[model samples]
Target chain A: MNALLRNKLRAFLTMLGIIIGVASVIAMLGIGQGSKLSIQQQIAGMGLNLVTVVPGSQQRGGVQFGASTMQSLKETDVAAILSDCPAVLAASPEVRGNGQAVFGALNWPTSLYGENESYLQIRERSVTNGRMFTDRELSSAAKVCLMGQTVVKNLFGEGADPVGQVIRFKKIPFLVIGVLDSKGLNTFGQDQDDLILAPYTTVQKRVLAITWVQSIYTSAVDSKSTADAATQIEETVRRQHKIKASDQDDFTIRNQTELLSTFSSVSNILTILLGAIAGISLLVGGIGIMNIMYVSVTERTREIGLRMAIGGKGFDILLQFLTESILLSITGGIIGILLGIAASKIIGSTMGWPIVVLPSSEILSFAVCTVIGVFFGWYPARKAASLDPIDALRYE
Target chain B: MKKLIEIIKLKKDYYVGEVTVHALRGVDMVVNEGEFVAIMGASGSGKSTMLNIIGCLDKPTEGEYILDGISISSLSKNDLSGLRNQKLGFVFQTYNLLPRTNALDNVELPLLYNKTVKTKERIERAKSALESVGLSDRMHHKPNQLSGGQQQRVAIARSLVNDPVVILADEATGNLDTRTSYEIMALFQELNNKGKTIVFVTHEPDIARCATRNIIFKDGVILRESEVKDRINALEMLASIPLEAD
Candidate 1:
């Protein structure tokens, strides 16, 4: 301890390597963990037990046309999935088109979605004001619709009740029956509350004059059975389309659990990569300790000899050097932890990145510092302990 | 008188690559308690080899070395260190005191290895040792702050702090001027009068004349041995030397 204090500048410089290593490890891990948690939260907000079936791409003469171009899925697939697939809780057929909605003198461009009464349930959305359009209204091909928070805000002004108000889309008048609860922005930064929903029959017969639906959205009995519901929907759709055995699926089925796993795995790899890079810095820090210790042992050779001549045992010399290095590393570890937490907070606020510091990372870094101290400190201490008293005394 | 050191036919050989250099060849010597013995020789004459063996810092190839009635050949490395701590003291020509440490702390160094000596007792013993060497006023001064003579005095204080059975000094006055050399020799003579067994090694005949007995060495063997019938009084010699102008 006296020796280390005597060479204050050298000791602090040696500890700087360890300090930077530990701080970077902790900060990198925090960012990685924070990003992973944010991804999971956003995926959870999407909905529960959801399974979406979309028309696969059409490949005519090997020149592939992208997804939703085949028109493989139809309105009949929704009925077939609800009745045949016992795992399904509810299902809805969807058709969409872009149009400008007008209310009085106010107008805003928005997406128009055509869906049945079960669409809100499958998507885990609810009407905040008024009620949903009835089955009688759908059978009569009623021009009734529901307005999302964004559309209502743009057409009728902010906080205005658009229910019972009339809006026009493509020169056709429609009555707004209800207002959807606000959902804010999704993971992709797209506004969830920016669309208007109407009966699928009204969209197909009155708006587009098309017979086939674009996609089918369904919900499973529970979150655990989401994959099973997707499989059953695939089987029923294939049978309806007459896609024979040993042929490729004409419609692709995706479930929430599969999407969640895919996203989590990607984030997990990112976390590991970040940790490994930080670990390389830590390894370099250990090498720095070894280099400094070697130089210290050489510089103090005569001192070691004098101590030995004065009756200090070899083991005592070894213990002295080892203790010095360990003390250096532990002190650096403590300062690094504080610095890392401060850095993480700064990054979180300034860069707008999520940062979550785990207690386990702190504990792990502390333990690693001790191990590094011992491992890198061993060889030089042994060299000091093994010196011949006579030769060492004569050393210049 | 009880014998503090006993060596029978001590032999030390050094193998420098292919050839062997006989550092010490079949030597026998002894020093009884309360005796001042000086071993005098030139370089390569085995005087240092003899001192190293007596100090328990080196092992003899073919002999028995017993210090304070314990056989050195039978002891392990750790035991030899413990023996050096408890029974033998060493004073180097260069005044090997720790650089940044104060005189008192340097004096207290040997006692640090003796775990039984508590900090309080160690400090008290170190203070008394410094006082005995006439360095009480310089206790807090570091080696760099002190003069050459003062640094040697600090080294002497360090050796005395352990209260060893024999104090082995190699060329103790070699680095000092005539006046300071006599002054240090007078300190040793005073310590000897108090019954401290001193073994001083030097090549200078005048310094050898300060001891009660002298043993001369040549070609790794004892050339001659005699009692100093006309031993020089270091105090009287110090009085004869002219003091330097301030």
Candidate 2:
């Protein structure tokens, strides 16, 4: 304690590396954990026990157009999936488009998603303001629509009741029959609460000027059967398209299970990568501590000799120096954790990114810092302990 | 008087590359209790080497040293440190007090190495040691805050706190001015008079005259051993010279 206090500036500078290393590690891991959690939450918010089927790309003379351009999936395919796949509980045909919505003097650019009553059930979205489109409205292709929170805010004004009001999209006036509860944003940072939903028949006939649906949204009875539902849907779609054994299917079925697994694996790698990069900084910090400790041992050689001559054992000197180093690192670690949490909160609010300061990461970094202190402090402490008392006393 | 230190054919050598330098040839010495002994020699005469061996800070290359009946050469490193803590005290020419620490804390350091001493007892003992050295008022002052003489007094108090068998001083007055040297020697004479054994190394014959006995070294061996017939009173000598103002 006396030796370290003798040079306060050097001691603080020695602790600086540990501080920066721990802070960076905490901040990076916090951000990574926040992103991972946000992704999982977004996936959960999308739907439960869900699978999506889309038309495969169409090839003409070795030229391939994007998916959903082939028009190989239709409304009959959705019905066939619901009837043929026992694992499938519900399904909906969908046609999608993008257009500007106009109400009074306000205008908002939004996605026009065509879905049915079953789509709302499968999507787990509840109408907050008014009733949903009925079966009568679906068969007649009624031009009644539901608005998300963002559209209600932009076109109708915040907290405005737009139910029963007529809004114009693509020059066609549609009555607002319902409004959905806000879902905020998706994992991709796109606003999930910025779109409008209408019956698929209305979008295909009135908005898109088409007879074919582009995709189908289906749900299994429960989460555990989602994979089985996807397989059954795939086989049904392949049979409906009449593809031979050697030919490629015209549709592709995807399950939330596969998406979740892929996303989690990707995020796991990302978290590890961030941790490794931060760990490098920690390693550098440890090395800095070691270098400073070596210099301190050398500078205090005479002091060591004097202590030894006065009856201090080698173990005493070793413990003293080791305790000093550990104290330095642990102090830096605690301060760094506090700084990291503050920085993470600031970044979260400013950039609108989710920030999670995991307790596990905090404890782990603290433990690692202590270990680094011991590991780096060992060589210098040993050198100080093994110093010859005669030579040390004689050192100038 | 009981003998406190026994030395037999003490020898020390230094090797620089292929050449071996004999710092101390065959020599023997003993120190009895309540004695003020000065070992005098010019540089390269091995008085420092002899002092180091007697202080248990170094081992004789080819001899046996017994301190308070424990053979120094036969003892392990830890045992040597234990013996030093239990039975030996050291004062250096540099006034080697830990810098930036208060005088009381500096004095308490040697006692900290003694396991038998309790914490509360260590503080009380250190305070009395400083008081004995007439630095009770300067106990809280750091080494840099005190003058050269006061710092040496603190070092002396530190050596005495353990109540060792002997106090080994190496040129303890070498860094002081003339009056301060006389003052420090006066304190030493007082300590010796109180039944404390003292062995100090000095090159100055004037400093040796203050001791009751003198052993002069020349070329790695003792050349002469004699008693001081007229040991000057350090306090009377200081009174003859005018004291300087701060």
Candidate 3:
């Protein structure tokens, strides 16, 4: 304690490196964990049992038209998969396009989603106000739509009621029947609440002048059966599309399990990257500790001699110096943890980013700091302990 | 009195690169309980080496040293340390007290090594040791805060804390002026009168006059051993000197 106070500035400077190292480790891990958790939550909100079927790439006269252009998915396919695929619990046909939504001299560019009432259930969202399009409206191909929060804000202004009003998509007039509850953003950074939804029949017949939808969205009976439902969907669509056994599939099936694993793997890599970088900085801090401890041993040669002369064993001397170093590092570690938590909290609140500081990381950092102290302090303590008292007491 | 220290034909050699310097050559010495002895010699006469060996800080190249009935040659490093803690005390010319530690803490150092003593008892023993050396008022003062005489007195207290069988002092008054030297020697005389065995190493005849017996070293061997015809009591010597002169 006296030695540390004797060189307070140097001690603090030494601790500074460890402080920064630990703080950065904690903050980086917290931010990474926060984003990972946020991503997982967003995906889960999309429906854990959800699966998607889109048109596969088409080859015409040896020329490939890229995926999503073939438009092989139809409303009949949604009905067929719902009936034939036992694992499928719910299915909705989606005909997607982009257009300018016009309502009383106000216009906003937005993506249009043509889907049925079941689309709301499959997407795990509900109407904030008003009602969904009825089966009567869907059968008659009525011009009725539900606007998203972003579209409502852009076309009608914030807090403006748009239900019971008329809007235009591609110059076709449609009645606005409801507003969708907000879903901020997806993992791909796309705004999920920025599009409007309407009955598939109206969009396919009036806006695009087509009979088939662009994709089919389905939910399985349970999370465990999502992959089975995807395979069953592929078989049913294949039979409907009249593709032979030797021919390539005309549709592509994507399940939530695949997407979730891919995203989690990416997040895992990012967390490890951040942790490894933090570990390197901690190593640098450990080296700094080692350098300072060496200097301290050299400076306190006389003190070592005095203790040894007073019947202190070599082990006692070693323990004393080692304990001092461990105390220094652990103290720095605790302060760094506080600084890290504070920094992450500030950044989280100010920048509107999610932050999660896991208790495991805190414990791990504390443990690593102690190991670093022991590892780096060994040589210096040994040097102090091994000094010959006859010469050390005579050292200038 | 039982023999506290017994050495037969002690020899020590040092190797500086290639040449072996014989620091001690065939020296025989005996120190018994309750005896105050002074060892005097010129530089390179092995006085310091003899003190170090007797203090258990080093081992002789060729000798039979039985310290308080324990054979020095067969003891391990840990056992040597234990012997030093339980049996011998050392006081150096520079009064090698830790600089930033208080006088009481410095005195408590030896007790820290003695596993038999508990923490609370260690403090009380150190406090009384400080009081015995007349430094109770300066117990909380750091070594740097104390004068040369006071620092040496603290070192003496440190040596006495364990109640060792013998005390070894190498030029204990070398750094002090004549009056403070005499004052410190007065403390030593008082400790000796209390039945503490003290072995002192000095080159000055005046300081040698304080010990009851004198042994002079020449090269590595003892050249003469004699009792003081008239010992100078340090307390009486200090009374003759004026306070202002000190």
| C-alpha DockQ of every model | 0.55, 0.56, 0.62
Of 1 and 3, the candidate ranking higher by TM-score:
3
Give candidate 3 misplaced runs (Cα > 4 Å): A5-7, A34-49, A54-114, A124-129, A133-143, A149-160, A167-174, A181-195, A199-215, A219-251, A256-277, A351-354
Candidate 2 residue-wise lDDT, B1-246, digit = tens = 788888889889988999999999988888898889999988999998898889887888998888888888988888888888888889999988888899999999988888889999999999999999999999999999999999999999999999988999999999998899989999999999898999999987888889999999999999999999999889898898886631
Q: Give a tens-digit lDDT track for model 3, residues B86-186.
A: 88888999998887889998899999999999999999999999999998899999988999999999999999999999999999999999999999999
lDDT digits (tens) for residues B101-170 of candidate 1: 8999899999999999999999999999999999999999999999999999999999999999999998
The segments of candidate 2 whose C-alpha lies over 4 angstroms from its true place after superposition are A48-124, A132-162, A165-176, A181-254, B244-246
| C-alpha RMSD of each candidate structure in angstroms | 6.0, 5.9, 4.2
Per-residue lDDT for A216 in model 1? Answer: 88
Winner on TM-score (1 vs 2): 2
Models 1 onward score TM values of 0.78, 0.79, 0.85
Instruction: At residue B204, give the lDDT of candidate 2.
Output: 78
